[model samples]
Target: MSRTPQAQTRTQTRKVRAAEPPLDVAAWRPAPFLPRSDARDPALIFVIAVLCFLACLTTLFVIAGDRAAGGWAAQLTGEATVIVRASGGETPDAAAARAAEALAGVPGVAEARALEREKAYELVRPWLGDVSDLDDLPVPRLVAVTLDRETPATGEQLTGALKAQGLDAVVDDHSVWLDDIRRAAGVVRWTGAGIFLLIAVAAGAVVAFATRAGLAARRDVVEVLHLAGAEDGYIARLFQLRFAGVAAVAGAVGAAGAALLGALLRLVGGGEGITPALPIAWIDLLAVLPCPLLAAGVAAVAARLTATRLIRDL
Candidate 1:
């Protein structure tokens, strides 16, 4: 009597397994992590390298911009502005002179400069359209006071002292503005961190997908190795090494491109508010050096995990 279909299928499977030679596990030299001739397609490598380079450069620019903005804020701290409103009959010149004298005697005051009428007019021109009737407009006398860096005066103390001198004085410590700037800087930093994380994830995903495709393409070779009793670890190592190599090359290219872009941007002069100031500290660049190595390491580990899991089921 003829065997059942399931039994016939099992017999055929056994015969096919038996026909395959026991792989000389020791002689089964796994391919190195380096790209095989078929896998070293320049177009694919170039595309990956360009993506990595742009991502790294964008991250560097954001980090550098934040540092430069922070430095600007620190350099301007501890400064105060004293605005003296013009009395009904008082001339701005007279009010400014009196304010300067009172401020000169104040302790911790480093320098005091009364803004010129023309300078003040120019400042308000942006909003007022034109300053033709300067004398009619009741513009206050502004005294810009720079305090000693070591002993900066608080806004309250300065205002109290000025009020005692019989002048209606308003002291602005710029705390609100500074706080806004700091908060903006924090937002930029966090955004940059998020971008870096996204790029890392993208890189890992690309590497993982490429590795999986390469493994699938070489499924026949893997089957022969499996039939010969080669361990899963040995097969996985070959793919891991190849992915590591690709990641390393891509990372190096990306880093170099970032450095070059940074240099070019620095060479271009920063004209007013159009261009951002560049922070080109050696320590800052050094901090980013590990990014590429980390990318390569992550890619290799991801590839290894993916390969081993797939091979185990086979």
Candidate 2:
């Protein structure tokens, strides 16, 4: 009983339709990147941990350096030292009295006091070593002056004003010390920047390696999917989603650990003053908190790109 031509054609069409692969309904549905329970590979976890630790250290160093520099600058600013050269056989006390009396009348002077002999000795002791028996030593009279907060004087103007008086006084404005502080702060900031750049590069390399490993592990599955006519995008997405999940989990853990360490360091209290050692202000912490998210985003993007390119080659 040979079938009619129309019946044969209809049968052949049905057979062809049946032989074709089923539409990937799973792929069409939102394929969420589910993280593997075993995704926390030891090497990858270690790398993330190290990067987080370095970042946290860098944060602490920058904060501490800035605080120290600011404190030093504040203490030194608006203050001046007047050193009076004495006439022959004139005692420092007599010269200091003359200088103090003259400075007291200066319009911008807020408080002027002749540094006591003991204070002068103490100041020089660090550098000159203890010179307790200084009765024969002819050190100039030192007067410490603090300016009114509203009436700051420039270094040159203050120096000229002091010299104009017959007191033979020289003013030291401490600019050199402030300049040193500024340089130190700059060095610390640049060092931290270098460390951060290295961390970023290392992170990218780690992500690339992880993506490659994942692809190799699932090579057979990928081949089977390709044989069944799965689109390249579909296969690449599976890898991308997996890596993104892993990166997110790692980022959270790394960030939390970094925060905890920062808090602990702050509690120890070894800074210049009573403040915490590494006092990261709330705003600073908020600013730094996004770093981990940024790192994770980079990792995810890198993984996606690497996977797509690798699959195309395969």
* Model 1 lDDT tens row, 1-314: 99999999999999999999998988998664334655454554565576677677767767677877787677657688888886757788788777877876778888877878777777777988865787788778788888888887777777877777788778888888788778888888888778777777777777777777888877888888888888889999888887777777777777777777666665554332215565654444454466567767878888898889887765
Model 1 clash pairs are 23-228, 33-241, 33-242
Error of 1 at 138 (Å): 0.6
lDDT of 2 at 153: 64
Candidate 1 lDDT trough over 10 residues, lowest sum: 267-276
How would you encode candidate 2's per-residue C-alpha lDDT over 19-104 as one tens digit per residue? 99999976786533334555447668667667766776677668767877777777678788888778766777988877777776
| Maximum-lDDT candidate | 1
Q: What are the runs in model 2 whose C-alpha is more than 4 Å off?
A: 1-35, 39-43, 104-108, 224-234, 270-288
- Looking at model 2, report the run of 10 residues with the lowest lDDT sum: 269-278
Candidate 2 versus the native: TM-score? Answer: 0.78
